[model samples]
Target: MGHSLKKSGLRQTRYGSGSFSSTYKFALLISLSRLAIEKGQDSCEGLALEYTDIAEKFIELYWKQAVPYTFNDEGQLILNQNNDKQAEIVNQIIKLRKIYSSLELLRRDSEEWLTLLKEVECTVKKMPVRYLQNINGQNFEFLYPLDQCGKQLILLPQVMYCLRQFSEIIEELCQKRWIDYIRKNSTNAPILNQLPNLEQFMFEPSRNQLNAVASVLVELQECKCFYCNKKMRKGSYAVDHFIPWSLYPSDTGHNFVLADSSCNSKKSNLLASDEFLQKWQERNEEQDLVIVDRISVLGFLTDKERSHKVAEWAYTHAKENNYQVWQG
Candidate 1:
């Protein structure tokens, strides 16, 4: 997915497609197999790395099978997998991985192969975290934030894809008693919190990211309330997430919008009072033109009032519009 790190211009790096490296694609397959034996399911990436042998094998297979390709059809665009040279490399890697996996379980490994595999595995493990950390630590805050340890990076689309994939994997694993797998790597259990759960299996935009998106919505919606088309006047219009934070804390960004306080609050969490919903339905889903007094919309409401209602409206609106909603 988008999160897969790729080298960009001027030695700049970008998130990967979440695809395994050619030499290491089989590593994922082997890792899954090992995990199934231990926990009866595929293990999370972090959890899988706890076993050096499994991790090594996986990386080896990925590099071996990950041969890039080319298309002789001479298409307008030559995809990476279609590039002739790369494809050959990838095919070779794939073949090697298969051969290695098919070996008898009790067979002894060749000394050269074992040594090379260990080196490859360690290098793969160390390189990514280091690269991501370096990028994040760099003062250059271009469009994306990179982790100092190179272990974390974000790509809007890649992050989305990973979330979907992770969700799918977690759901599949749920069919088995995967909880018992935790015992195999107790030292890493604390990190589980960092892993996404089924309910929150997506990245939540940060305050800055949310704000950036909100600003875009303001401009795109022409500084008017999206629901009512009411012209926004003075001060910043509130941006709210379409999905209420209360119900879905994980979903955020570009999906938010600008709205007058009354319409905004009524649309809180994309829901409102029964009476409001009735009126909304009556208006053919148009936001009610009759809004709360301008005084209230202009921050005249009490802190408590805003905290309970207006704040929710603001936060949700910000999120829906993809503005960075500051938590503080």
Candidate 2:
């Protein structure tokens, strides 16, 4: 039998709950859902997630938002994450951003990186993790128990399955709510009136990082587009996500493919055909070592197994929903 899940409870906590003081709740939900996909299985068993691991996810989620958002060439301002003040995690990331240009650089400094993780873990355990399941004045306790989780937060039985099963919905809902919280914050009101693609700004990988990835992919693909196999001249190709970022937002090294500008644009936000999917899987299997050795240093997660698992999920989802497949 399939695992039983209370979709209503999840909805109530995320949507019907009272106003939020900070965006932590949304981040926590997104983190849990993504972790469920990455670490847990589609089973009815409970899953124990380390506090430090959760903290790492928190950093990745908040890192981009900590930077100043530029609007209309006037000036740049960091969006406030809390009603009263900037979120603590965001402030910490902002401080680190001054010292490091990319997450990969900061990660190389073991001392500073570990310190940030420790701090973030403490904040996460104290704040959102403590109060996420609380609806109104009562504790729902549907996701996890507050007191039972010591070193790690344990997802309740069937929670992991439900999270994985509904990952896309959970991700979209959290992102939308997170954006709404930022928009509603009084501090952000003035600057966000004409906000341009807040979702992309908040979630998408940095353009600089993609450019760096493009350079590596050029060598990997031998200046040939993965889709058309056509020779790509300098400055004529782009790094394309094998599984669309819109489908699965997280960047995994194995999911990237070098494609000419035409194929990249044509394949925008659509799953490539089955022929391409098979080719992508084969490429990852053959070049797993090279991808990990080279691309992981570029700051992308480079697990071939994990990337393939995500692709399996994405393609399965597309098939179920009859999503249009790009015929490249």
Candidate 3:
């Protein structure tokens, strides 16, 4: 309902709910939709994803709730999740995820969560032919609750809303759970690992960009790092993708810049922390004739407008949720 990129019309889940909203039910489905798309290639048939490939993918979204902070005279914070505290936070997040996956939701008196998913499958089977696609392959097997990995999924017209809802549901659920766990008056002291970090999720690691391209950006920036205005040596600077490669994997020319190796490393895959949002946007907006010529020869600015749109879409979500962007 909030936002969607669905191709077909929305199909309401037959079973109603108070425990989970209709939007959330679709959110769950949407998360699955994303998983299927991420693992498979586009084809006339549809897209598919591995069943086991889910956990790692889910973890990326699972940690979206833990926001981090650094204290100075007032408090402390770091550019990335390099500290022991962050590690503990990640460990506990994984632990909770294991517990969560094990939960059967409505089947307290019966089987696992997959039982309910079976029922979900039954409901879906009755839907029209388009939504009732097949999922059978040697590489794919039913994951239960979810589906067989690499199973083709036919997304509805409101698909984007469904995927967007998955993130929203996750952030809300994680915060509420963590808050309840932390605020409860249990006899046991809160295990630091059990206590979720306040930092939201950061994107996963990506392959490094080409050095030839990195050097070109260095010259373009007058040797000043994009994140920090500091000078960077020719062979020392790292080329960073402004809108993380995880979020937007295509290697766009305008999306890259030379930065202090530390800054590039520290920024990791998180969006540029809010402070640098202006500079990042301004750099993207630079389209002078001379700059355009240089960018054309050294790198590719295939579609500046589209690139900016993708960045703004990512930043919009972060800004709305009060998630901190990375600043190294």
Candidate 4:
């Protein structure tokens, strides 16, 4: 019975207040967009009561962006609570967690979050929404997306925009928390890196890096996956970090490799096992000749040593921290 959102329904400039960025608001929009698309058939009926638990999705988003790993000498990455023990980092995480745990992402019976949720919700709900009410004490039924809402033309642009916004925020916060944590503790460190945010590249890659990973990496590797040495094609390949970008923020020619999509996704942001690392090293050495031209064209990094130091730093961290390198 709620009134439909109007073109000017948005009130808050963004989600979260004050110091917090619009990350949560944007992420929820992306999540909501996904939920709607997934349940389009029923939702388009304008009465399916398409339900979702926004809180859960927000938590998952938090972990995917914030999770950091410490490695043991065997060259593997593992979770280390101690790494997040610093009072400042711990406080940041605590604050961030409170933001997640107390998210007004979904409308609740409590009047406080409901208004915030409504204001945020209108940013994406252009079409008529029948209603929104809690069902099982936790889950919320977003109920009904008019025909216009289901159209890809309307939906796709919003989805991509939300996703790009989501990725930028994730990239910023991930670097702020985890990378900063590593830097403070590792003054004498060899090579610590930030995990490659695969989403960022796929969706909104840096203006400074190889904008064409499939073609460039294919040429570099002779159309072979850098990890498995398997043949690849434009659509079949995944661009991966030779040194996980979760460990290193830099994305340049020397650090990139083409891999089977399955292999790259499996690796996620984990450090590669010794075998793969050695292979990566060899590939890096071989690509040094053409690196300048390729990277310079993109105007990213021309220094091959930056990539080398990153690799060295990553391996040394794995060696020192006893992190378990990802094997699969």
Candidate 5:
């Protein structure tokens, strides 16, 4: 059943098959999968998601890419997201990025933020939401019914379950395809063909943002390594993903930990041991408010329960597959 669902879900992503003109389809699919994990449950029940919520996800997904991607310290250019013109959302976000240094700052200005969200919501509903399920000129309503939903997108029963179950695979596929779309776009291919680490630039949180987060973590963790409990000198510690980004790419506030360089390097891309997991959970519970207040300002999403849910999903997948766990 899992294999079947994976196949079906993957097929939906390739609906138009190499004819994508814009990245909206990829963005919408990713938003749905992440929302399934963050908002839906493990059950086979249908989930109703507001178009506004999905619009916010689209903004988050495109926000980083809207900035100029620097190459070789010589030049910077924003990758064109459409064949003929920059994506409307990307263009809008690029303008906003000029005014606001980070996503959180834009979010804080409720007036401007609401205006953007409303615009994005209209676009999402009118564009990808209308076309994502169309396969080879036929409407394939595997995800949701197009006619029934008005203000909210309702995930068909078991669609939510499959999205949650296969989120990692789905996310990776979406990202790879999104990257391919950028690389193949006639305007981008000339310059982006040789760029390395394009995936990191497209998805990962910026180093500057992470550095700002590290400052808050340094104070919160009392200057000790999160894993070893060792006191670390200033300027030597790194902000480590308590849940590695390779496992789950999204950055949530409580999933960060201050680790010394050694531990951070040694534990790269591996889930921490169960003991550390417990400690991390305890730390989050204790510092939930502090993390939300501090880190959200730095442009990271911060919800302790949501972070814990993602952790639960990650750890379960790890244990089932006997994934290597870092012991510190």
Candidate 6:
């Protein structure tokens, strides 16, 4: 299912819209732009993959820190320290603007570095605002739903009020990251606000983001392949996008499938259905095998061919997996 909005949801409110100081905004944009350029590579089309990289790094380096920690009954640190470390790194990053400027200038001439940075910038500029738009109308607090890979708009008025209060700190960090980067880089470099392609707060997740999603799935399934019923250690499997990213780039969490890499790649973008069932049956005598296909970005899914194919695949998969089929 697609993302939904709650009419009475007060969670969609923006915090302090006018609160970000010029310094913070500029610093934040710069940091994002720089990180994008440094960590991502350019695609065949010349656009940098930095947007993907930044998204990956953002989640990797900072996602945990952004989360709040609670203590246990024994007064031990019950929460993940990884998240705490991320927060610390972020704080350090806030301080790096002043300290790193001098060091950054000395290394500006490295062609390899410059090339990488440029690529990152190219990618970040193309990310869509759809992710960020989910926060509109509420306290301006939105989370990239870790489990769902989408966003959840808050609805409780109290939560909304608290989010507005919390945004002051988060927004400060966001702004600081931008300003610091600008100060460190040359004026000739791209200005973040001026980038026509810049998305608001939403970022197109990178492969790493998918990995994180995969990790969550593994945890959900106790580190086993959803299809093969095998133990999946690190590097033994991949999280499949039931709807391939190329075909349905906009989808986040729900469209994901945890499966063996070979099985996933075989089904890429091909509608799961009866024909697939026939082929799967032919390949394996097991009647319990369920087959899934990758979906397309174009055309109405309800169209005869697409719908039939999907239905066939889903039914077959259900039967094979011994799972109940809940029709949407």
Question: How high is the CA lDDT of each candidate model?
Answer: 0.35, 0.85, 0.44, 0.45, 0.87, 0.34
Measured with C-alpha atoms, the lDDT of residue 1 in candidate 3 is: 31
Q: Largest lDDT belongs to which candidate?
A: 5
Residues 42-105 of candidate 3: C-alpha lDDT, one tens digit per residue: 2223333342333333333324333333333353222222111333324444444454522212
RMSD of 3: 15.4
Candidate 1 residues lying further than 4 Å off, grouped into runs, are: 1-203, 234-236, 243-254, 271-328
Considering summed lDDT, which 10 consecutive residues are worst modelled in model 5? 8-17
What's the C-alpha lDDT at position 2 in model 2?
A: 22
**Candidate 4 Cα errors over 4 Å, as ranges:** 1-204, 207-211
Candidate 6 CA-lDDT value:
0.34
TM match of model 3 to true structure: 0.41
Candidate 1 on 72-151: residue-level lDDT in tens?
A: 34422211332113334334445554555422111234664555455544554554322422433443322124343233
RMSD of each: 22.0, 2.7, 15.4, 19.6, 2.0, 20.4
lDDT by residue for model 4 (1-328), tens: 1222211112121211222222343344434433332233222223122222343333334333343333444443322213223322223334444454322222222464444334323432431132122122232332222344432223322333232223324344433443333333333123344444235422233433344655676777798877777887667777787777655544556777778888888888888888877777676677777776654445243457656655665576567668777886
Look at candidate 1 and tell me the lDDT of residue 250. Answer: 24
| C-alpha positional error of residue 271 in candidate 3 after TM-score superposition, expressed in Å | 1.4
> Per-residue lDDT for 1-328 in model 5, tens only?
3565556657766554367779999999889988887788778899999988899999999998998888889888898999888999999999999999878889889999999999999999988999887766787678899987787999988898888877888889889888888887899888888988589899998889989999999899899999999999998999999999887788888999999999999999999999999999999998888998999999988889989988887887788778899888
User: What are the clash counts of all predictions, listed in order?
Assistant: 66, 0, 30, 25, 0, 29
Error of 5 at 245 (Å): 0.8
Q: Candidate 6 lDDT, tens digit per residue, 238-265?
A: 8765534432223323345576776666
> Against the true structure, candidate 5 has what lDDT?
0.87
Question: Which of candidates 3 and 5 is the stronger one according to lDDT?
Answer: 5
- After superposing candidate 6 on the true structure, give the runs of residues whose Cα lies further than 4 Å from its correct spot: 1-204, 274-328
* lDDT of model 6 at position 2: 9
Query: Once model 5 is optimally superposed onto the true structure by TM-score, how far is the C-alpha of residue 241 displaced, in angstroms?
Result: 0.9
Q: How do all models score by TM-score? A: 0.25, 0.89, 0.41, 0.39, 0.93, 0.26
